[model samples]
Target: MITKGDGMGGARRHGGRPDLVRARVQQGMSQESAAQALGVTPTTWARWERGEQGVRASYRPRMAALFGVSAVEVERWIEGWSHGETSSWPTTDLGDSSPAATVKSAALLWRLEMDPSRRHLLASLPFVPSALGEWLVSWNYGTPAASAARRGAGRVVGLADVARINEARKAFGQMDQRFGAGLVRPVVVEYLNGTVAPLLRGHYDDRVGSELMTAAAGMTWMAGWTAFDLNRHGQAQQHFGQALRLAKTGDDPLTGVWALAALTRQAIHLEQGTWAVWLARAAADTARRAEAPPRVMSLILVKEAWATALQVKSAEIRDGRRAKQVERLLTEAERAYAKGTTDRDPEWTSRFEAAELNAEVGVCWRLLGEHRRAADCAEAAVTEFSERLPRSVQFNQVHAAEAYLGMGELEQALGTARAAIPVTKALTSARSVDLLQRFSGQLEPYGDTVAVREFRDHLNSELIA
Candidate 1:
């Protein structure tokens, strides 16, 4: 029964005849009982027996343990090579900024509103926030423009939505503390889609052009993110492109760099590694051309490093050189961002630091299948986000779990993933669903087991709903 000719020229190496079914029948165990033992659904297990779907590799060990057989035996059956079948699973991964980042960012707004020190500072300064905001931005950016902005803090020119804008900005900060800063993508995108987008689409006077452009740039970036979540890849690309264009209209280099980074994320997701590197590099280049603060520029460089790592192998000559330079530049940026000895910092650059960079690099390593490096970088990222622990924390947790999965530690991976699931449920980020799907896929190896079945049912119910 081992070798059998099928449609293909190659002979199929078949395992036992529906091992789980045969074993259960031999032991006089009912289907439900067997299913429960293996953490699987009766229907799911039934499907496996009926040759509807093959089992995943992760379940092999669990099934082997339950059925008193070796994992190898379970693995053989899991492949289902009865008629010369081949498995096409992707082991290596590429990290794309998920929509969940926006949900997390929106949540931070709630937290920032509560910070008394920030409020008191605004009230006491008697200076327009734009002046202080610009000054702080300068310190982070290392630009003469920031110095000009600091000196220009002459009077209180409270713009029309100053109070509301301040409140919203504070809330954005709080989200970083609650969800983790990296998860701001969806939160920001949602705000724009629900609130900002509609406003932009409505009639507007030329007088509001600057404000409108700023808002549009932000929303366009979000659209790119939402398109990514919906898996409308081409749409996502267009959104990113629009964001960059809008940023230019506003002459907002910081926002422009931010938009380019989003483009890099899309490239990474689409498996266009070279394109990703090119995009990241261009973003950094754009930032350099701008009169942006050093902190902002650092973020762009860090992104460049991320893109390079994704597209280039460390062993390759040109790629290795570029990636190494990116890594060094990223480190430099991290050092500059965290050197917050200044009196104040712009709210925009407040989230920049070694933690975010470490998290990103960790993702880069995780995607490359460097388990040790991935886990280390992930740990560093988690540690970095420990104080904020918002949606960014959840993203990092998933990153850690992914690294654990790469290390062949399913238990840790599942446990880490579980911590982020409900804790971040209030956020409507597609990455959450993607993470759940990933976990389910990892568990599929034990198709007929109780845990796998329970999880499958749980996942199916939610996905269907």
Candidate 2:
């Protein structure tokens, strides 16, 4: 609704880690001086620039404001630097909000996600890393009682905060912020290890606290999804368990279904197809019994269909038929979505969408060697997903890249993959990174080529930048 881009003039992250460090140098700041200011080593900073390390919390703010340029602006620059592109779509403004305006500007910022030109608006604002970390504490039970109370009035509104956190978390999930797993995985881990559990155990009402615990647990599981996406299987497993407990505490059946479906998908991704189908079936059953919304049920079915397709090896020829049928099912579910039907429907139907199902099917088809169909399905997914998810439009880009690569269009694949790099810089989810990494790994054979190399090098150097 509100578009603001020009104000981002000084809000660039310098376009890559190397450029950031270089900019500090250009400003005449010596390595020692820079390290002292950010509280890190010259070597550590260099490694970060090289994408060898995660961007530490302590350094981001000071480094971002160093040249009177917002760290976000530098992050913007890093995308172009990483992908070696002069311009990219994801670097647009996310509305006209300043760092302090984030909580107030949530809705406007949400809308900015679709407006590609204003995409970088959020990143441009130098978020106080400490604030971002503590923001969760308000909703997370782990925060000290006084601290949580301080944020809220007398009693903590953990329930409401949990719901609100879910809102942010979904957008975060949809965006899969990082193009690679290295940066986002740790951020999620930090959130999980630090904020989520404490919130679950913190004092609150039986009803409100239960609901809040469910939300936290669900979000906690989401952190695992990020972990799984990042290939941190062990940590992801632990998170999933934690999510289950929290979901149960809240007596939220939908949350349970969410975790189970994730497990099913993970099983399929790991090639344990049988387990995938079994898990999906169990999840679906529970979802059906529990009265989730229509949308949620659709999502669960979509997950089941995809997992089923993968598990059906010998039945592969007919897999296409099943996939088509799944698409139809989701459409039906969508029609029922706005009717307040989810409160009446099965528990698993709350978060379903045709676009997401399409994306899932596209991946399943690609894995099944149906390249032509995969391309078609992926293209559709990219269109729908991008329309719905502005902040993380790049998620579907990975599937699109895979389809392009699978179709043997090297340049097209490379182009799409390269395009994804810049868009991914602002995201904070390991899931997005995992998808991008998959696409990049596919392009690794193209590493020697100029395009691939540029993308690789630029992304590697984006940490500090």
Candidate 3:
């Protein structure tokens, strides 16, 4: 019998029998089948049925389809209320970036990331910080700083071991560049937990320990970055935080600053413009404190400019003052780039060359409402993004498309979007997928047109297939 109740009150409205369970039973499907259909774990499905978790409203349509029920029926079944009884479930999204929550979430991520099998369990974990914070304390909050005086008493480790680890780290970085983070995160995480963790605990002298810790910290940063690329923001936050702690422990200020810069990128993509600015400034300040080489400093400055551009584009008051500040930051970035040579910077900064810089400047201008310049810079950057950086090319293509859309060049936007589709399709970066999704949303107004519809269809086929 279908039980109905007034669209008020809690799960008690249906005597604590969640409609999710009822719907599934009615459809004659087991939890495993439902989970398989939804592409989630059976455990996750159980939680939903038991009311231990709430389903994202965006997922409702698919859930409804899977359960062989109308979307309205699923909604009524889950909430024990009819339409208009409450706000949509999306309003209840638990993801937020308060400082305390961020730290707690990062710590949890550090644990979860070490166990690949348990990583799936993270989907059930409550909201973690969606991005990293700027403060030095943020990184060191949950973890202890490594001390130089502490020496491992196991088998003695030497500079050769540390060098090998760095080499492995570099190799993983190259893989990520060519194939995207989704393809490389597992390998990186395995290396960290399997190989690097052992070396960290092995016997080493003071100097070797410092180098080893710093190397480990660098790998951690890479892990965090890969997580971010894969759209695992909380995991990314935790990894970066871990890396920062390791950097401090090893007394490697440069790595710590770079970790902060990575966090800034997270904030920017997560649309926390204010947080992005804060993190970027912290990175620059940290660099200055360490007297970082001009090349590294220049990279940090550009990151700040990028963050500032995000702020200006997203702010209610997009006036000349904000625009000028963005320009000033960009000018400083250019000067730094001019003054510093790549040879003086770390291997990591090698990828942030002229092409990358141009792409950033283009994106900055686009966000600030300078569509013409943004398009030009973006187009040029696209040409400069060689095969070495597959994901970057895909990312810049989306930027180019956005510029065209802003300038009302619908055909150009559609064309550019289509070209970027295949590039993003093969890559596992969640940010890359998000960019395409956002681009699709941007085309919704013009979706009635043949070109726009064709592009949308192409996108849907690629993503869904």
Candidate 4:
């Protein structure tokens, strides 16, 4: 009564599912009957067995029950069927403080990035806001011990290799700033998988190994940043997490601070204000432990201010106390930024100069409903940003436009936003496009005026074309 050839053909065609097929046979259940028990269609069951689709987490328990196997065993069978695809990878375990484990985890992530078939699945992974808290806890309490040189049969890496990675990181970062992530992320991933990954697995002394890990952390952070620019949230989060672990393993708390701050920004973007605030605070604490430069502290404070401003915005009735807190944080950030750069400042901190600070502060002001101050700060940021960062210029231009819109200056807003169109069209940043889209939504109150109509036409043409 097992029903001849039911689901077995699909399983055989897909291959590597002999165990799954045997489980069904032992239970004396046809594919149709199993599907009925699981409350899924027969075709869905067939696809699952064929490795064409994944088993949902909710269905795994029932599946384990039906097969008389543990849930973990069910997962292992699915993973085997998929040939251990990135889809089966767990999002938890940000990697321990061991250099070997860090390298292994980072290599896995780079491979995930490079695999075309599984890249979409990785991007589709949900952003876990709760992970921010776990990461913070680990970062605060985790003390990594020095790892011994590996005796693996891989090439011996050196400081020269570490130098090359840092140089490549700088180049990729510069390109990403100018052109956006769409053009730079692929090349960065290629370098990480093809070049950096092998070096990480290779042999090296503690000194060289630590530097190598730190260098790799920088490149990985760049990879995450570009993914974020392209609005690939889940992929960005994973890269950031891996980067944090790599930094910890490398004994480079400064780089770890950067990763934490990046997570804070991502949390803010996702509107998880509480997580953002905590992550930013954690970044500040880590930076202090590293004795980071003033500019670094300024950057962390700005992130904290941004998160606090959001909290104020989300209040049912504008929270005055939090509003004052935002202002105080911004003031402290400005004071710290004024101390300027030093020899100790990391290369990555260069991007958070005056223009970036003004841009972020303007955002805080706009959220607090101070339209005039927001417009002035935004315009200042626009003027300060150079052509070397076309994407930044475009982003600030849109922010200026939004601030103008906030003040009911339709013509000025439209004109400022129009100025960004050319640059926006040239760049590949999803965030820039998203900002423009939101600005378009804000123009609805203008009721199809000639200026508004013309602007909309231009935007539609540029975006669609």
Clashes of each: 47, 52, 1, 0
lDDT of 4 by residue, 366-464 (tens): 999998898888888878876778988898888889889898999999999999999988998898898898899889999579999999998999899
Better of 2 and 4 by TM-score: 4
Give the 10-residue window scoring lowest on summed lDDT in candidate 2: 143-152
TM-score winner: 4
In candidate 1, clashing pairs total 47
Candidate lDDT scores, in order, read 0.54, 0.54, 0.72, 0.83
Stretches off by above 4 angstroms in model 4 are 1-87, 90-92
Worst 10-residue lDDT window for candidate 3 reads: 88-97
Selected candidate, larger lDDT, 3 vs 4:
4
What TM-score quantifies how close candidate 1 is to the native fold?
0.52
TM-score of each: 0.52, 0.52, 0.75, 0.84
**Residue 96 displacement in candidate 1 (angstroms):** 30
Could you tell which candidate, 2 or 3, scores higher by TM-score?
Answer: 3
Put down candidate 2 lDDT per residue, 364-412, tens digits, no spaces: 6776667777778777866765645532357667677787888778878
For candidate 2, give the lDDT of residue 197.
39
